[model samples]
Target: MRLLPWTGAGGKPCYLSTDDPHSPLSRLADDIEALHLADAAGVLEGARAVLDDPGAGEHAVRFALARAVESLGDTLRVAVSRGECA
Candidate 1:
């Protein structure tokens, strides 16, 4: 999965690309809301772990991707909570 975030320095919040962004969770945003939430959570958790742990052993590039994914999830949650997911 490839995630691009808007926040903090540079154009990305966290930098990591996934081999697959079409997970069941991502499908929620398109075909199912519930699945989207679950997938989004997965992305966020991955990002949060990297953010909280600098030496998490994740390569710099991968770490950045995780951060970006986390930020993207946060953005999505905000939008959903605001009833903008219609």
Candidate 2:
């Protein structure tokens, strides 16, 4: 069973049960995962910039933090789906 990157209704984890990793759904999941990782990289950079800026306001920091948290969740989900977690 391969855990998909996206959740189902009610925020439940979705899984793919297939021997063919190249199947349509599997490919879609792979693509989405790649996107999530790419977005995470950008979010990390932006968050760092916000944190390093002394002139940044609370709103700016909070926004960056929210995005970072969201990206972190996505990245963690991808890791778990890929069996990278211990």
Candidate 3:
């Protein structure tokens, strides 16, 4: 059982049961995980910029925080899916 990067309906975690790593669904999951990781990298950079700005407003900080939290979740999921985390 492999945990997919995205959730199912009602925010439940989705899993993939397959032996073929190159299967269509497996490939799709791999592609989506890659996208999530890439997006997380960009989000981390933006969040750092926002935090480093002394003049950044509350709204800007909050928005950056929200995006950072979301990206963190995605990145964690990817890690778990790849067996990088225990």
- Top candidate on lDDT is 2
Task: Give the number of colliding residue pairs in candidate 3.
Answer: 0
Residue-level lDDT of model 2, residues 1-79, one tens digit each, is 9999999999999999999999999999999999999999999999999999999999999999999999999999999
Provide the overall lDDT of each model, using Cα atoms, as 2-decimal numbers.
0.54, 0.96, 0.94
Worst 10 residues of 1 by lDDT: 1-10
Better of 1 and 2 by TM-score: 2
Show model 1 residue runs off by greater than 4 Å. 1-31, 57-86
Judge candidate 1 at residue 44 and give its lDDT: 67
Whose TM-score is higher: candidate 2's or candidate 3's? 2
Candidate 1 lDDT for residue 65: 88
Order by lDDT, highest first: 2, 3, 1
Residue-level lDDT of model 3, residues 1-86, one tens digit each, is: 99998899999999999999999999999999999999998999999999999999999999999999999999999999889986
Q: Which candidate is the best by TM-score?
A: 2
Off by over 4 Å in 2: none
Candidate ranking (TM-score, best to worst): 2, 3, 1
